[model samples]
Target: MAIAALQHLTDPRLAGRIVLKIGSSLLVDGAGCARADWLRSIAGEIADLRAGGQEVVIVSSGAIALGAAKLGLDKGGRATLADAQAAASVGQIALASLWSRSLGTHGLTAAQLLLTLEDLEDRRRYLNAASTLARLLENGAVPVINENDSVATQEIRFGDNDRLAARVAQAARADAVLLLSDVDGLFDRNPAEAGARLVPVVQGIDQSIRAMADGGSASGLGSGGMVSKLQAAEIAERAGIALAIVNGTHRAPIARAAGEGQGTLFLPRRRDGARKAWLGGRLRVKGVVRVDGGCAAALAEGGSVLAAGITAVEGAFERGDLVEIRDPADGALARGLAEYRAEECRALIGRRSAEQAAVLGYAPRAAVVHRDHMVML
Candidate 1:
């Protein structure tokens, strides 16, 4: 609603927080040098949004590209993982300096954060990252985030900034995500083909929509294509966040995306709780807690999973790790952050605090998993 989300919606919604995913090509060239003027324009746009009371987070790609140039990597050949990481190691500093200078020119402060997909996957690290972003926003500093290419391996890498931006949006509790690309947006067919037309609005990422992106690959110097944009849209949709893919190569691309039918706007079905959204998006659960019928009924009524209600603790999980809550029938009910370590939880089974204290020489935490940190599976 404000300036980055879908302004075309029948009712304009106030999407206060937004995350912008800028591809490598938009930031640099195949030679990996910074695109100074274009970056400044973007910085100015960000400043305008901030003046209008909007908080922005950026997931920028270009470190590797710039680094490649610094390292003298071939423009025509693919860089190896080590080469890419090495390039990122050198370029990250330049990338940060570029953003800092650009944003500073507009009287805005820039904060940089390097992250890996694993960072977002781990509950503790995710919370830490989220907290850092929140504090930066609170202080009116625009955060420029990127994948930790210098340290991450192929097994743990996000592969592209698009999905990374979506995950960051969820962590930052953003209402919208904007992916700036070379193309205007998703087209009905390959834009190179005759009669190809842009799809202004995507209601949802269905089979037909995905099929439209079949041949899409990375554009410019970016490593991702239209398929990556769709994947990002899917992630945003899960968290009730709207996503837009717009042509950043043009003037006022952000403003253009806000205009009707100017970009592909992927709408969310509805807004979901930030914690629930994060919980549901997690692909791994460290443990399972089984509760009795009464506990299951209470949980269904929106109650927490209390220590006295838990019948069994399965799996080895540390405190603050992800866990699954199950019923007497062993059916999955919900997922949450564990308040106690698996060992501690096992010791607290069916015991009151006083009883736990008598047996273990200390009182234990009240719940196996707090309702506030849980989401129904």
Candidate 2:
């Protein structure tokens, strides 16, 4: 089984939709400039993948590094949020131009997308992003994605592109995620340590697996390290997407990683099983709604929760926030995204959908918790 899993990692044709995450350390030189030769080689690999009828998305990290270098802030010092943002603003243009020129050599168009954490957290924005990427893919354009660091503060930042790539994979419904890093693959311990061994296949992530990751960043120019990569793997696994971590210094790293088994492959759970697990997982429930017995029964029958059937609302929550549905007896029945804010939910409780506009001044949706968003416990 382990050998088969390794072979699956080496099969470049296994996935139709692929998300490649390039670390800053691999894309930037020690002097903090874009590695043009490396970019061109990777672009050539992408061209080959497209020729083979595969769609590719690139989640790259180098704006900050390039920006820092351009601004003379590459002296190995910690940069403030303002400095980082300034650097990102200056470097994003160069980064986009490099990717555009590299891919254009093979007659491919590169579409640049800048995103923040909120873009994926808000349901509406998430759908918008997904739709835009889908259209780009349909038109045969490679989406070159990067964090919106110019506007992101520490409180609202993704902190690393590794986690952002995982979110992108989920949003794009990618079949696999490839993380190109400085190391060859995941090691049982720090490779610098004596007797460290490579872990070729990972079926699950646990405390033991997490302990293997080093806390330090891979390079001075990058924010993520093995820890963030493991976090990314966990996110991808939950979405039933396979993730592979491999060395990026080699030529045609993507093809080699997929066709030579030169990395650690994290196996994904079955798609349906993963979805069910995600729905029932220990998500922080922000609010609770107590519904009538009729609504509880309807929920069990895969129906949405109607405002007229809700008897009470508890806790504060905004629209698109995860909330729990409970029976009149206060027993949990299901969980779903709230269509209305807590205050609006209070005003609309026990009211018909027609009365929503009168009470809230806007009738955005008819159901309090849409059936498509709700999951039975």
Best candidate according to TM-score:
2
Write one digit per residue (lDDT tens) for candidate 1, span 251-356. Answer: 6677766664577888876556766787866655789999999889999999999888999999999988899999988887888999988998898899875687
Model 1 compared with the native: what TM-score? Answer: 0.74
| Candidate 1, position 87, lDDT | 85
> Tens-digit lDDT track for model 2 on 1-377?
32235345434567778898999888889888788888989999889888877799999999888888888874422368888898899889989999999999999999999999888766678779989999999999999999999999887788989888988988788888889998988999999999999999898887799999997776767898899899888777767788888999998887777677788988875453433434433235789999999999888888999999999999999998889999988877888889999998999899987788898887559699988877665
The candidate that wins on lDDT is 2
Clashing pairs in 1: 217-225, 218-224
Cα error of candidate 2 at position 177, Å: 0.2
Per-model clash counts, in order, read 2, 0
